[model samples]
Target: MQRFPSAISLFAALSFGMPALAEVTADDVWTNMQAQTRAMGATLTAKQSRTGETVTVEAQTIAWTLPEGIGSLTLTAPGFAMVEQGDGTVQILYQATQTYRMDLVIEGDTATLDVRMDGATPHMTASGDPGDITYSVHVAGGMTAAVSTHAPGEAPVTIDVVVEGGEAEIQYRVTEGPLLAIAGQATSLPGRFDAEMQMGAEVAGTVFGTVGGAESSFELNLPSDGFDILNVAAALRAGLSLDLKSALESSDYTVNLDFYGQPFSEERRWSGANHAHFSLDENRLFYDASGVDAGIVMKGENEFDSPVDIAFEAAAASALLDIPVSGRDDPQPFALRFSFDGLRMGPGLWSLFDPAKAIPRDPASIDLDLSGMVRNRVDLLNFRQFVGDVSGLPEPELISLALSRFAMTGAGTATEATGAFTFDNTDIETFDGLPRPEGAATYEISGVEGLIDTLLSMGAIAQEDALGARLGLGMVTDSVGEDQYRGAVEINEQGHAIVNGQRMR
Candidate 1:
């Protein structure tokens, strides 16, 4: 695949205000586009939804350079010529045959270029092999680009695959910058813009056998303020210090991906509709995306020769991620928390594996709330320093880890578990070289025996393995009453293991 910079950066170049002049030549516009594209960077924002769950990703522009001499064209007298039109526009044309032609028009602040080749042979750069390909690119002004390609012959092309009617386009406009520039006036440093991309493409050959009709699309509303754009340029130069908080806070977006295949097929769509938010104070970052809604459906043929379909939905679905950015000792303590609500899946996905249908087929749902902290001078910001050169990294050390909350509940089965644990860095012998654990964990489970019996009857586990597993379980667990089982495991500073109020080691 040909990699390009994210759509946001492309839009930044596309939406830049043109200079105030009576006329702009096609070559002038083309040169400006090439130069601006090379020096530009912006935030790429997107959202994805799958089965009632939505996720948002905001990233700095990817550093991708176009191929050498990509925009250069050869012109000659008559065969290749530029003519001034009555409308104060210049039209450049290159024509040799019906299958090969190039046309470009420039008027006022807008320019358009279109190149097409049909039934032409493509020569491989290395082996000099011959293949047939037809492709065209249409650029409207600097804010929109569209490309289409097709290969009807069997010979492999430069991409090593045969594609059918692939098409893609990008369009954008400035929303917060100066809309018009004065003569001899310099453009401002930053602005806000809205951009969108519509693309559909498919290929099948030695690369991916026999797949077709795969497509995807994206839309973004982004900001390129002074502070963020400077940071983006710095990252392109030094590859460091990415400000995640600023990117997410700048925009709202959406994305969709769909495909079909022999063994499996998937469809996912999601969006963040102006409800995404982010904040950063020094080395602490807080993110909240409460307005995201998404869902996903997957279907495939199971190994048992039976078809299976699984789907999930979430109403009131939201995702959150919080992280301490600086070292733990930097005044603000280190902490982490991740959680979600209204997650559900089911109606016989498990039945494919359980032929006897012993497991419940009702819709199963889950809710989770987990949080923790690490006490040490560990610097999360310094993590990137070791990516390509680790010799400068500091010595690794452990201070302490604490779990403040661990809570989860499963609907339809009435199962719930809650626990907490803390570890001391100085006492590694207590938990076999792990930070000596100094806290207890408690769990409660229902239908304990029936589940085990059903698994045994289905021969999912060997008899010997089951016996060993049961023996291990018996040492750490005790029945509270009835079919319910409750147990607690704890480790002390002296390296002692205790279960259910009894010492085992």
Candidate 2:
């Protein structure tokens, strides 16, 4: 429904009246991509290849307009040359030896592009799949990367956003045969990355033939995710900021955020009827994400690091869930509500994996899977942590508030238990009572531990914090031996954590 200028006009403008602008960031890239696609009615991928180059794709059946914008490209590799005469025309040359491809269009605050080398394996692999991978990248509540979504009802275009340490992959079935499927994975995470997304939004996709085991994960690790959601949001139109922090094999990233406009969509809803699966491996997670809104069907996997084998439905909603504020007493008013049913998530949560103070994997335990909620409010003006109000919910979907002193719950298959005893529950058949919860909560604590020792050691706890001597042992195999003890008891529910008996969210 949006309109963009023509490419000819854009080139003309840039040829003459340029400059008088500012710097560009990842967000700018996204803003430009979306705007250009809307204008040209085309699908574009920027940063899919090396930077400074643009490539256009004519694979899908679609027409798009170009926008008016400014771009400075410093093409390198195999020697490049550019000449500008007194006139307005310019001559650029590239060494024929370097066979790369680039297509870009800039029109009125929109930039869409596709850059690729002559030969690419991953791109050729994910021919047809569902979902735009660019959507998966969420830089944890900070400046997102740059890119845009091609409008729906248009010819679906596949883009490859390959940055220094980011990769986007996706798979869809365009074969038009008995089975029409679409799925994939994406990421730009480096183990060294200490990224924390207090507020997060990102989109990425990939085609995963298999979803299990360390090898599968190792395969995924080969591909990293790039592009930040916050950065892209800022580029589209409303120039805003986002907060993001990350570290990778050889890269580290950081971004402060203040996002505006629409925060993209928040539903990881992948729709493809026959594309469903159910998996349970390491960790003690149980998920069943199958359904229209949840996903195409029930299918999930667990990292080999998990001690127990787990499986569940794909339609099952997130045990730990967040509700969108449809309407509020006051947009800036000081009240908030959060809830969860059964959450499965990554590590570093409450340092549950730490050997020093984590729980054991055996006797795997957790009962408040039904539902729970928390309703609280505070002076938004002050904006201090660990301080708020707590209202009650009629009935909660989950209820694992704290271990004893203070603790919080999250979602995921594996987490820190009391001590260490990899849950020996590979019996997918025996697993039962898995729930799709709907509940609410209202409470607060400070410096809270994810779970208790026997709570963890006796297979009671399951959280990810500073993995140490034990989840509850209060000590771990200090790798650095610097005594870098992570004595965190922070409290956080909704947006804060509880530590000790106080609030340290």
Candidate 3:
């Protein structure tokens, strides 16, 4: 456990000797918001609302730096207001009369959120809509701040975020609610959600990097029934843990979902379990994520029109991804690996696909391992600057890519492959109108001919299509066993393609 100064202490340290203003105004609040946001490499601009005079402040665009030190972040919204209290505290509010929309982007992640709230009193009601919403903030002491949001209804909700003693805490609770407008239509959602989180050193470091190590945990629970959307009763519980150390970041999480429904007057049910653990550490200036494991399990009835039930389990899935920060002029190391234990489908489902059970019903596992080097490095700040501006922009590039190792394995089966390749900037016409590749690869596959024949006999594939597929396979493969074939492909420096030691082009 590590100790950090409270929010007040951090503020005081940053604003040492600054006088406490006797009066707080919207401008002051906006200035403070901008100052804090800028630390995260974000820009926030305010303008007049387009709706009416009642709307005082509208922040058009708020963009920030992306995590993993990559790309950019953008958040677009059309709401918010600045208000001052007699106690000199300021509040930022968001309430829309019509539809409320927020678009958020963090690197490759993106989400668009829409919400509506309705309350009974004018003070509780928001600007655009008729929902009762009360959002406010106050500085209780020199080092403590409290922010709260409330919505009154059949299923009332209250959320509070408090920052004190160098830590930020969030708490949320919602009671079972009735119907609320969804996508402009009234929809019933009889459910409740509750969650709590506390930010410590690790979380602060990960977000701001101005702090030291941090550790954080999150828990959530949601149980509901009478949901017509999926025609089922559903419940979910999840927990997550995160940590950021000097040169490493790690996370562990798990989630469980239970669902119940009726099929043909019979009760059908199922449960799903998911878990994941991963960690990333800095290797000098570069970073690598390894020892990652994730899995999922589903056991229940096939509630749909399918002819079989399901008892699937996919466990022991693991992966590794390496990122290089070497300059563009130098080739950077890159690699990726992924593997899964097996995929197990229930016997009933397997039988539905093959009544005679020609193929083995046992679980099938797959693995892929690849390692390579490439040239693709871009300045983080420069790339972010061009995210929303394309003209005269300089993007990242891969001038050269080389794969030193590539392998795929199908456990419990005679299906496997291995290969390597290299590509440079030089152009070669015989290489599919692209830069020609140099290297060779070999593959071994068994039971494929029998599977194709079985599919044809079972009316799964047309005879004409089957014949064409066989002819194509014959062009590259040599039969080595009853149902096994060996194939090799090579691309020479002179842009010639060789199949099984025979030059084709």
lDDT of each: 0.37, 0.25, 0.40
Write model 1 residue lDDT over 370-415, tens digit each, in one string.
5566543445444344357666544334444455444444322345
Model 1, runs deviating above 4 Å? 1-275, 290-294, 300-308, 315-318, 328-348, 375-384, 387-392, 395-415, 462-469
Model 2 Cα lDDT, one tens digit per residue, 1-505: 0001122112221111111112223233333333323332243333322223322221222233322224222211122232322232222223322222223333223223333332111211111122111111112111112223332234333433222222222211111122111122323322211222222233223321111110011111000112222233212222111111111122112222223332222212232222222222111112222222122222232244243322222222322222211112322211112222233332333254444434432222132322212222222112122135434222222212322112233321222222111111222232253222211222232222334323455454354533442454343212222222232333232333334334533
Scanning candidate 1 in windows of ten residues, the lowest lDDT window is 124-133
- Model 3 regions lying over 4 Å from their true place: 1-311, 325-327, 346-352, 380-383, 389-413, 428-433
State the lDDT at 41 in candidate 1.
33
Q: Kindly give the stretch of ten consecutive residues in candidate 3 with the minimal lDDT sum.
A: 180-189
lDDT for predicted candidate 1 compared with the true structure: 0.37
User: Which one wins by lDDT: 1 or 3?
Assistant: 3
